[model samples]
Structure formats: C-alpha cells, structure tokens
Target: MIITVAHQKGGTGKSTIATNLAVELKTSLLDLDKQHSSIIFNYKRAHAGLEPLDCYSIAESQCRFDGQRPVPEAKLDEFLDLFKGDPKTDLVIDVGGFDSPLNRKALFFGDYLLTPCAPSGTEIYGLQMFEEILQEAEDIAGIHLLTHVLINNADKRSQKRIAEMQAYVKGKPEHFELCQSVIGQRISFKTAYETGQSVVELHEGARTAKLARAYLHSADEMTALCAEIRHALGKGV
Candidate 1:
C-alpha cells in the first residue's frame, strides 16, 4: 500500500506520524518534504548504531510544475511510473506542510492518505482547505481519494477540544474519515524524536517508569492506527 502523510499547515505532527509509521511498519519512506526531516531522523538513528529505516529521497528536482500548480495528470503518471512499478513494496511518503502541485499529485497516487491536524481553529480551517484540495484532485483523477484525518498531538487534559474536533469530523464524512486512534501531546514523543527512537524502541532504563509507560501507550495507539489503516485498504492486520 502507498500511504502519503500530508497537511497544508506546519506543526501538525506530519513527520511525527510518518516516522512512527515507517519505523513500526518497517516500510520504505519517501521523503518529499523540503525539510527532509524524515531523512534526518533516520540518519540520527543510524548514527546511534540503531537499525536504519529503508528510505529514499524524492527531491523537488524530480517534479515538474507548471508555475506553482502541478499538472496533476503528468505528476500522477510520473509517481505511478516510478513507485507503482514495485508491486510488493509498501511505501510511505512524507510531504511538507505547503500546498503545491507536487503535493497534490502525490495525493492522487496515494492508496491511503493520512492528514494530521491539531485541535485548533486554524488547524481545522486548514483541514477544510485540504479537503477541498483533495476533492479537486479526485475530480482531476476521476477517482475517490481514500483519506483519513488524524487528530495528533492532542492535549490529554483538553477533553472539550478533542470532543469538538471529533464532532467536526463526524459532520464531514464525505471529505475524510476520522481516525479512531489519536496521539496525545506527551514528552515521551519529543524524547524519542531527539534520540531517533520510536516509542516502541525505548528501553525501560532509557526513561523513567512513568515516561516509559507513556511511550508504550503511544506505541500501542500507533499500532492500532496502522492496523485500522491497513484494514481500510483491504489489507490483513
């Protein structure tokens, strides 16, 4: 399955979700974001003498854009020609938080799309705009884009905000499905990122018992989300 992790606004935990999925699933990661955050994280992991992730860089140079907009048909074909040629490989693409022709083209090739958004008014507005873009891509591609909107970095104490976000997503079932699994704003995630280790990779001695438990919980949440995503794509858990 080809999965694309994308959002138009930054700081929505796009890299966080992408890296976690890649590490947990042991899939190849295609870093299309200009920031190259995934690549850097993998490097950190490798430097730490840890097992490295299978990764590739699909730099912006490989894409052809007409002005600022990508010609969807050409871009879609380009991606399909390159990535779809390998039928057995599960690929994950991490796109930067900027709306571009390349990003739109990537969306068309995704068998499953995961968009992470924080619980905020601006982030919700960004999600709405992203849905419209996806709709436009669907029109251009003549196919329904399978998409899931993930609520990430949610505050554990803000039940009201989480409830509101859930309600908003429930009202827009046609645009994107809301993921039942959520990632909370926890310090363990930051610690794992800095060390180039996923929550699943953290040893007991590496963190306090409370933090280790938090990481374990986050890892379980991520695993459940991955299973849900695969099942949605008609793949076995």
Candidate 2:
C-alpha cells in the first residue's frame, strides 16, 4: 500500500516513521516530499561514527519543486502517473509539510494517509484543520479519505495535553484512531535523521536501544493498521 505520513506542522517524526517503517517491511521508500529525507542519516545520535545497517531496497530521495511561479494543481497528477502502475508494493512516501505541492500530490495519490500529531494545543488545532481539509479534499477528489491520527513525539510538557486531544477526537471513528503505539518522546530519532540513518542502524550495541526497538515495533503495527484501514474502506482511502 502507498502509505503517506503527512502533517500540517513539521517535526512530528514523519520522516522517521516513513524511513523506519520501510525498514520494518524491508520495502523501498519513495520519499516524494521531504527536501532531505532525513531517514538517510541513521547515526546522528551516535557520538562515535557508526556504520549503517545493510541498505534496504528503499528509493530515498527528495521531490524537486521545479517551478518558477506558485505550485499548480497538475503536480498531483504527475506524481500519481509515476506510480500508477504500482501503488501497492509496500510503498511509503514521507510527504513534505502539509502546505507543499508534493504534499497535495501525496494526498491525492496516497492509499492511506498517516498523520502524526502531538498533543500540544497548536498541534491539536492543526489536526482539526487537517481533518476538515481532508474531508473537503475527499469530496472534491471523489476518493475516500482513510486518514489515521497517530499520536507521536510527546514530551513531559505535552503529556498533559493528550486528554484534550482525546476529547476533540472522542466521537470521530471514521476519521481518526488512537494507534496502539505511543512512540514516546525520544531524542535518538532526531539524531539518527540528522546523520542520514535510522536508530537501528546507528547502534546495534545501543546501551539504550529501547527507543529504537519501540520504533521498529510501531512500524510493524503501522503496516497492520494500513491493512485494516484498506479493508475497512476501499483502495485510495
């Protein structure tokens, strides 16, 4: 399935999820939106340079916004055409922030849109807006929007805000889901991306590999969630 991790605000572990999830499935990644696809650097958290794990069949790269003027609507069609032949090969797209043209393309082309949200008020507002946008877009595009809301990257300060977020999404079953994984706060993820790799690749002898292990398991869970979402709705949901 073509899973697209997108968010209105940046730094919600979109790249990390896309990269590590590909690693979990041993599938290729089509990073069609990120300018850096930070998932490439897997050793940012390591003090000592660490050798990356064996390369998976991931097509890690950034989407080129080759336009002089503002972005047009046809960009979505162009990207969709590239993968029209195959959108169900364990594909993962780390779409850029919500406002980018590539993000629009991804939304139009995505089979399952995975939105990573924090519990902060600002993030909550963004998620609410995102839900509205998705609903309108789905109506316009004539496609079912299977967008899953996964809580991601909550620090001590943010933990207090989840109940509020939970309240906002209390009755929205068709639009949201509380993922089984918490993906608790961790700095290793930011570090790994800064160095062009995943945490698992950074240190097998990780004195503290708990975060890495959680991420791997979360990715596995995401796969199952994607399947469930597809089954519940139709393709291109």
Candidate 3:
C-alpha cells in the first residue's frame, strides 16, 4: 500500500501522523517534503542509540522550487518509481504543504490519501480547498480516490468543537470521510517526536503519573487508529 499524507496547508500534523504510522506499520518512508522533518527525526532516533524503528526504511527526495517554477515531473516520477518495484512492502510518503504537479502526481499514485486538519475555522476552510484538489485529481485520473480527513492536535476539552467538525465533514460525504480516531494536542507527542519515538515507545518513568497515563492513552488511541486505517484499506491488521 502506498499511503500519502498530504495537504496544501501547514501545521496540520502531517509529519507527526506520517512518522508514527510508518513506525507502527513497519513500512518504508519516502520523505518528499523539502523540510525533511521525518528524515531528521529518524536521524535523532539513531543518534540517541535508540533501536531503529522496526523494519523501517527511509528515502528522501529533496526538491527546491521557486513560486514560478514547477516541480520537475521527472523528479516526481523517480521518487514514485521507488515503490513500483516492491508491491509487498507498504510505503508512506510525507508531502510538503503547497500545491504542485509533484504533489498531484503523488496523490494520483496513492492507495490512500490522508489530509490532517486541526480544529479551527481556518483549517476547516483549508480542508475544503484540499477536498476540491482531491476531486480535481480524481476527475483527471478517472479513479475513485480513497481519501480520508483526520482531526489532529485537537484539545481534549473541545468535545463540542470536535463534534462540530465531525458534523461538517459528514455533510460533505462526497469529498472525504472523517476518521473515527482523533489525535489530541499533548506534550508527549512533541517529546516522542523529538526523541524519534512514537507515543507507544515513550518511556513513562520520566513523566508525572498523569502525563505518563496520557502518553499511554495516546499510544493506544494511535494504535487503534492505525488499525482502523488498515482495515479501511482492506488490509489485514
């Protein structure tokens, strides 16, 4: 499976979701984003003498683009060609925020496209625009795109707002479906990422009891969410 986490909007936790999912799925990560956040996180994991993410392989394609210049089509093709040779191994791609031919190609190649959005009016508007992009891609490619929208970095206290977001998504069934699992804003996520660890791998001893419990909870939630995504894609758990 080729899973692509993409959005034209930034600060939607794309790296967070892509990294954790890659670790959990034991898949190869193809970092197509210029920021190289995922690659850097893996480097930290290695430098800390941490056990490498089990069965994880990584590749990066760094592209520099000016506002006027289009991303090279050949470059996008080269990165995607990496997956064509290995159909059995799953691949996760982390794309940068910015609409480009490169991103569109990735979207077309994806088995599953995930767009993460925070709970806010502006982010919601971004989601709408992203859905339109997805539609355009599907129309051009003549394929039924399997795209999902996930709520990331939500506050635990904002159940009402979360519900509103869910309702809004439900109203647009043709565009994308809301993910059942929501990722909350928590310090553990940041700490774990800094150490090149997934929430499930975070050591609890260094944290207060309450925070430790929260980390574990997030781990469980992420595990379930990963399973849910796999199942939705008709893959075995």
In the range 1-237, model 2's lDDT, one tens digit per residue, is 566777767777787777666554444455444454533433232224553322212133322322112223445365445554363554566776657544655777776678887777888778877778777777877877757777777664665587676666666666676664555566666655665555555444345667556455434444565455445435432
Q: In candidate 3, what are the lDDT values of residues 1-237, reduced to their tens digit?
A: 788899989779898899899888877776666676777777777777775542222223433321111234456565566664355767788888888776787788887789888888888799888888888888998987757888889997998888888888888888688898898888888998998888877744446777777688778878988998788777767
Candidate no. 1 TM-score = 0.86
Spell out the clash pairs found in candidate 3: none
| Candidate with maximal lDDT | 1
Ranked by lDDT from best down, the candidates are: 1, 3, 2
Q: Each model's number of backbone clashes?
A: 1, 9, 0
**lDDT values of the candidates?**
0.77, 0.58, 0.76
**Model 3: residues with Cα > 4 Å off, grouped in runs:** 53-87, 203-211
Write down the worst ten-residue block by lDDT for model 2: 62-71
Index of the highest-TM-score prediction = 1
RMSD of 2: 6.8
Candidate 1 vs candidate 2: the TM-score winner is 1
Candidate 1, after superposition: displacement of residue 74 in Å? 9.3
